[model samples]
Target: MRQPMIDTYEEAIEAVRACGILPLAPLIPDHPSLSGITLPERWHSDTELDPWRWRVRFPGDGIAAYGKFMKKKAILVASDLVPSVRSLLGSSRSIAQRYGDGLISKAAKEVYAIIEEEQGIETRALRAAAGMKAKESKKEFDQALAELQSGFDIVISGVRAPRNEAGEVNGWNSTCFETVEHWMEGAGIPLAPMSADEARSRLQARLGEHSSPQAMAYFAKVFGF
Candidate 1:
């Protein structure tokens, strides 16, 4: 199916608000996606329409909340639905509590600890602090980061660029991770008393309205409702 149209950041924000949950890239074919709707060439352009850049900067822009919420892939949830998404996908248990439950891995615990100690640490710095800087540790490190993100224990608050000795940005941007509460500070996240079941039902209803049955089924399976 043809994707919806979004040519600028303003339009992207509106798309996310309208769709509620928008993947940064195509996951479920019929699910709403930034890449699906955007011009292909604009992806890495660092422009307003760049999906690549968007992943690095939800920017605390107040329109949508960004995270690796959908099967560990990046997604933008409408600001109003942030709490619902958190209820559905986030664990209320503390990181240690979750670790005791076997739902959180050792590496994941380590990663979360670092983010807790230093809010808004960039990916590379985070890995280093967690003792996962070696090339061989990349997979484990990435998995841990994804684990924290999926559980809503942490969020990508923004991005940082490597700076030269002269304090000039010298390299590609690195995404900054912070605890979900830390990220929500001063951002005015919506207030809604939603349970996981309620969030699930609401999401199902929303998808049902705009997505095909096949797409809806795939979404249910991929996101585990």
Candidate 2:
């Protein structure tokens, strides 16, 4: 598939809302890579035909415009499709079952709890709140965060760029995390109640059209389809 160039933030938002789901980049394992990806890079710096400009621009801009950001199947998903996706993937009961079965690690639980208490927090603030601020524990902290994301418990809701004394933006943007429910509410997105089996079946049918059987199975495992 040919990669699309999104020249403006409005264009990026329109693309995401339409797609319902997309990779943070233009990566499809089975396809040839003619160009790189979008959002995190400079918006108009596509001196070449790469999509980095669109990739870097989408996540933060989408969140502000009307979208949710979560690690879906290890890739970032910024879309209005989150409410339906979450409903299909897991419910409160399923999540509770995972916790009761000890599938959720102590560190992940701690990290999740902090985010729940604070509503929405930046990564650094989350680390401090979870008391995993030590350098050596960084890996554990990262893993815990990823675990939460993979389980569909939390998401990167926004990004924060610090401003200098003169009011100029400085440094890379820090990601802000929030519970899936909180994120939905903040974005004014609504969740439609759907049975887990129905949701999974719909997802499988949609993805199976484009993916190999093996890839479909991998997606099922990753997304809890």
Candidate 3:
């Protein structure tokens, strides 16, 4: 089911358009950045996925940064980078199984079953066991959180650039944070940072039971407060 690898950035863009996922990269003078960076006039396309929302993938560290960006967008497919077998049998699946069985919920199991069947391994007991174990671990939530944190850290550090002439970032710029904050505001998520006591009070009001101060602190820490 893997598509042929596209050699050029233009080909990749066309492929992404067909797949309905936006391709974005960081800005560079001689390179392309996906979000908010100006493009060469001749490179524009009429694709459904906006070029402005695409990312730049230069050589070296650019791939890492691009991966971080994709994670932020919730569209990074591990299967795209490595063989599906690697991703299916790797830490990603284990992590999914760890946090909550819900990570490998029924839908995921169905998908796995289909993949197994296609690979002629549907009756393989060992494969079945492995899938079940992954479900049991529920590690996906923690892994997903870790991935998000890394991307958030990258964004916050101003490392991925909409850079200046000397290659210095003009100011604190985070496309991912901006996108999330925008979404939250539109969804009516509160912008206020609550203190431990305040959060406890809010939780009590909502659930009729207060979370412990330690729990609130833990929540705050996890959420980057």
Candidate 3, position 105, lDDT: 43
lDDT of 1 by residue, 107-199 (tens): 999888888899889988888888888999999998888887888778777888989899999888888888877666547774445777887
RMSD of each: 2.4, 5.1, 20.1
Predicted candidate 2 versus true structure: per-residue lDDT over 127-146, tens digit per residue: 98888899999999998887
TM-scores for all predictions: 0.87, 0.69, 0.23
Q: List the residue pairs that clash in candidate 2.
A: 37-51, 37-52, 38-55, 38-56, 39-54, 39-55, 39-56, 39-57, 40-55, 40-56
Clashes of 2: 10
Clashing pairs in 1: none
Leading candidate by TM-score = 1
Per-residue accuracy of model 3 over 81-155 as CA lDDT, tens digit each: 212211111233332353356543443344333333332122223234434436554464334333533332112
